[model samples]
Target chain A: MKMISENVWEIPREGKMRVPARIFASDILMEKIKADKSLLQVKNVAALPGIQKFSLAMPDAHQGYGFSIGGVAAFDMDEGIISPGGVGYDINCSVRLLRTDMMEDDISSKRKQLLEELSKEVPAGVGRSSKMRLSREELDEVLSTGAKWAVKKGYGTVKDLKHIEEGGSMQGRPDKVSDLAKKRGMPQIGTLGAGNHFLEMQKVDKIFMPEVAERFGITKPGQVMVMIHCGSRGLGHQVASDYIRAMENKFGISHLPDRELINAPISSELGQDYYHAMSAAANFGFANKQMITHWVRQCFDKVFGSNENMDTVYEVCHNIAKMEQHMIDGEKKKLCVHRKGATRSFGPGKEEVPEDYRDLGQPVIIPGSMGTASYLLVGTKKAEEISFGSTAHGAGRVASRSEALRTVRGEQVKKELKQKGIEVWGHSSKGLAEEAPQFYKDVDEVVRVSDALGIGKMVARVVPLAVLKG
Target chain B: MKFKFFDHTADIKFQAYGSSKEEAFKNAALALTEFIIEEDIKAVQEKTIEVEGMDEKQLLYSWLEQFLILLDTEGFLLSTIEELKIDGNKLKAKVKGDSAENYKLTGDAKAITYHDMEITHDDGWMVQVVIDI
Candidate 1:
């Protein structure tokens, strides 16, 4: 590894690598990254045909199937390739924060009851059906219109769309989505699928940058907020499977470094089909969170006697591919940017960001582990120049699920959190154990690196008060 | 035991062994079933599934992926594999299981992945897969 700057390291372009691989991390984080296969995955991504600048990894980088979880790469629209591995299986797996008028102390006594109500209102766990079972036609509309469709169905208000990425809906062609994908997705809408998907009640713990926090509406400490982390559920998974099979059948690149890196030319019909289908799935993800937002409001109303006037802070997807024009070699070029386990961090004044936040920069929510503090960060202009405007998504895991389970039991974890005045409700003990806070790197360090590298700057921090995990 | 778990940083990893390739695939399916539901379920219901692939590698991939789709769409929790047959691209199997209501599901497996997937014949036959949860 060659040091490019203080917190950036480079894997020099080598055999079959079209470009160098870059990672934004401190020396300490780099040590951990070097110990995993993530660095190799970065090199593999650089090897992909027509990758621009470099295959970049965010501070929270970790080994994933083909692309590292915190991976980001841009491809030339006319000559590059689009691999399903770059987008991940859970299409548009994202985070949304809902700010409430109430404070933490006001809801402290009712935390347990609120958790119970949320658990009942939001369907979770394995093979759980959603409260809203849409017809085939309704599901297609959801695939096309995304959160806008959910809002039309009385799930949320139109004002919420303005704060969401892509204005709550991308350019999705519902016809591109297969019938089987619809079958799996139709019943899972509004449902929080299992494994790390969670709905947590949090309190404003600390304000790192008071000005940015104020601009983003984190006015005071102890202000209550809700963060939802989920995705398109089974529908996204099926779409990935369907496309990977199609790409493999059409382009038999068996000699490639990883079979999972199978891709189609971005200009090909197959690639266009995948782009449309994936956009539809991403819309499903957007609408999925919006529908759940409706139920979350209902849960609050059921617990607090009146609607708490929860407003959308911002919603952003970590897993996605978008067509954007960026400067390359001092010339503007259209590129397909793939960000898996990485968030889009369009800086201040970018037209893609919401108008209200145009001067303040986009709000990038990074959820920590259940027992840790999460951060709200703002994108930076420097990120757009160097990293294609991307940043870390979460505290990447250091310990495996089995290893975490071996060290502690879920009931014990729950007990410890309760002793600390945090209420946790999970469907299974094993699931809770697997998601133990100790399993992940400290989010504080990850954000610091992002700030140091000018990718993202910290705004506010929030700690979990009550957690509902699937 | 026909199957055992391994450590993968982000996903669930496991390997199953059997006397033949078909048996290995069966044991692999059982491993997925056990991962989803912790407790053993009775073989009260039966379903016959058929799939076709271009080769053995795809056959194994399609086999596991098909079962996952069934679990999501039909809620068919597996109790046991009654029979298995494979000839080139085609595969036929009969599996017995109960409805999802009869078992307590412990985990949610999103998909069967090709990441580091392998099938080999060392002593008998062995298959390894990483499931994204």
Candidate 2:
């Protein structure tokens, strides 16, 4: 195995490490890592109890709460540490795409109208709520049942669930979720909360792997697509907040360094409870995106006249922990895998993949920031060998929001994007400034790193045509 | 002292400039608390609450957030702050507050999150407090 490549370095298992740690990046990315403590966070994850194989970092790896963003770590179910930071505040923060038969030429003239309609139909901004406010019971059901809750409510078709990761519902107990978390989530079922979340209208620009593209049903170069990037919103935030506090004190019980890295053994009562609650919130996030997908279809119908021919490309959650099975040293073992700011990249012929896509491999949807190109990629078998079947999520932030706002004005960024023919919509100009294209690293570089590492293979490139931000 | 308002992604921030570090921190706390409760400081009476911290900066941050939390969750309108002292990393502050007839809270900030939070002194005796959204 190429443990240390041109930019990557592997920390071999020693002392407390149960497994090695592999970081995927170039020297340039590593320089950025040195400026921050994300590498230290990755190293900390390697020290956790019962960690398996390797703690992997994608090209976009950066400093984050407990586990660094773009970090992937797996642990045996019987022995492991589960920290809220590993999953992050936005429980199921994920990406969803919809492909249409319509071409770029068909929707060029209606771009502004489409953007306006989308902004109105999709609730956005901080504390934004949908027209449909659910009662406490309904909220619980949403958390417990996930996208199935929305489909049953007639928000979408059952077929939509098939294309979603874990069928859009992570099966587990919801009663473990706190009442406060339930209250916070009750009013925000389909809302798109602010900060880095967005809805972008795109056109298939180019095909890289024709075989994978054909399997994913993406053929024409100008075919229109819509991608929604969001998550569990307030409910998930509350869950994380409540649990971080719990862990802060609970980790004291177990005696771990760094209060920010507070955690409990996977078998502990506190850990099990947090996992159940986390899973419920993840479910809520799944249902939240599914509901928004329905409204997206409605927005498309308003513009294109009908959405019956539109199809869901895929829905995948990047911030989550899952119980999975992987081979370690030629022995198959069950492990709890934490993929924070990383996507599951199960290769072709995996059972978890949908029947239609089993031959094509899991679809890895990576949405670049506004004015940048998004991508569709397929999982590779090498990912299992390197990163426990995980890949980079997006163009990780290089500059903080404030840094972006200081360097780029919202109106100017908007002007530049418009000059490029990208239609943009959001609650405020200030919000737009925080998500300026300059705030992020080049996603093309991130994709290249993953491709070079053989974790994922690019299938298609998508350029934005219309955009919505919160 | 001169204070400037800045727009954070999810919160409004204030940067205060002063000849002394103590003044900078005190004013920063005042600015943040004032944003939570819109009221005239002259009209409110003063009652004090003491807070201690492990470090001077931590004490400053915790002191401000503690007061803000009281104002946010308990509806306490702070009027004045005094009796501040820092010995090594430890700090002690006596915060003054009084109940107002009616005050409206504008934002729904649950708590001061520690994400990317920072407090630093600039070259011109200006102190900046960056709060995570």
Candidate 3:
């Protein structure tokens, strides 16, 4: 590995590598990255067919199944292939923020009640189902229409659409999703599946860029907000499994370095089917968040009289693959950009950005672990040139759940967090133990790397007041 | 414990051992359930599962994936493997477990992955698997 710049490390193209591998990290983070097999995974991704420019990893990079988490790779649409590993098992696993007119003081006295209501209203953990269930036909509508279906069903207001990624919907072919996936998804509409997914109440503590924060409607410190982090649930997992099997069946996995990196040509029939199915699951993810947003509003209303003061700030997907137009070799080309554990940070003036945010750039919500600080940043043109308009999603895990469980008991973690002034509620103590603060990297440092690289600029930061997890 | 967990940075890794292939597979399944929920093995209910695969590795993957699907759809949590038989690429097993809703679950396993996965028969039967959580 060679240092390309101050923070960019390069692994030169060699052997089967179709492109060079680049990792964006500081010297300290680079050492931590090399301590594991993440770099080897990056090299493996570089070897994929039709890869363009470089296969990249963010500062928070960590070893994952096939593609390292925090990985970003773009493949030529015509000659490229779509790999399920590139998008991860949880399709469109994402984060969203909701701003409220209430200040921190308003929520201070009601913390316990608010958390209790949220825990009761939002179904979570293993084998959990939401009170709201859709029929097979209604589930198809959710697959196709995304958040629009929820709004049409009166779950949220029509005005909530503009604050979401892609206006809370994408072009999805519901027919591409299998019956089994549909069945599994029908009962999970508003549920939050387990493993690092959460709903947290927070307070904006600082504003890094007042101008940007003001334009984004995040003015003043001590303001209250809610962050929801989750994904497509069973629907997305089944789609990923189904497509991986289909790809392996058509083109045997003997040639691949890993079975999880299974892929089908983008122009092939199986590839199109996977893309459509993935989009359908992504739609489910959008609708899932939207429906949960309704429940969050209800929770807030129960605690603070009326929730009319609440409004969605923005929603962003961290795990997904999109057919996007990017500049390659001084010419415009369409590519399939896969971000496994990264978020889209499309820069200022992009047509896809919401109108209110077009001048300020898209809002990038980075949720930290319980008892840590989460950040709100904006996309930059520099990111469009360097990291495929993407940035780190979260403070990527540094330790496994079992490692965490061994050192810290769940009840101990809960007590520790309470001592730090952060209330925690969950289904079990073991679940809380797995998400111990030590298990994740310092998100403040992760965002610092992102800002230093100019991929995303920090706008504001919020610390958790209460956390509800599976 | 018939199995022990290995350290992985992001996901869960474990190795199970048994004197026979069927026992190894059964131990592996128990290890998986233990990772998710700490509960007693109550065989008040049972379900017969049949799966087809191209090889032993694929069979292991299919077997685990099927249970994960059941966990998602039917709220079924495996307590034990009452019986197990394998013929070439085909596998038939009778799994016993109570409903997940009645038990206390700690975490959710997303899906069983095939990354660096293998089943070895050195001295005794053993298999290594990584689960995406």
How high is the CA lDDT of each candidate model?
0.90, 0.77, 0.89
Q: Write the per-residue lDDT of candidate 3 for residues A197-297, one digit (tens) a residue.
A: 99999999999999988777788899988999999998999898888877877898888987888898899999999999999999999999998999999
For model 1, residues A110-174, the per-residue Cα lDDT tens digits are: 99999999989999888888887789899889999999999998988998999899988988888
Best by lDDT: 1
Model 2 alpha-carbon drift over 4 Å, by segment:
A1-3, A12-18, B1-133
DockQ of each: 0.77, 0.13, 0.75
Prediction 2 TM-score vs. true = 0.83
Sorting all predicted structures by lDDT, with the top scorer first, yields 1, 3, 2
Best by DockQ: 1
lDDT of 2 by residue, A65-100 (tens): 657889998988887878787887788899988888
Candidate 2 vs candidate 3: the DockQ winner is 3
- What TM-score quantifies how close candidate 1 is to the native fold? 0.99
Pairs of residues clashing in candidate 1 = none
Proportion of true contacts reproduced by candidate 2: 0.06
> What is the docking quality class of candidate 3?
medium
Interface RMSD of each: 1.0, 6.2, 1.2
Q: What is the lDDT of residue A157 in candidate 3?
A: 83
Chain A only: TM-score of every candidate? 0.98, 0.97, 0.99
For every candidate, the chain B TM-score is 0.95, 0.72, 0.95
Question: Model 3, DockQ value?
Answer: 0.75
Please state the error at residue A80 of candidate 3 in Å: 0.3
True-vs-predicted CA distance for residue A78, candidate 2, Å = 1.5
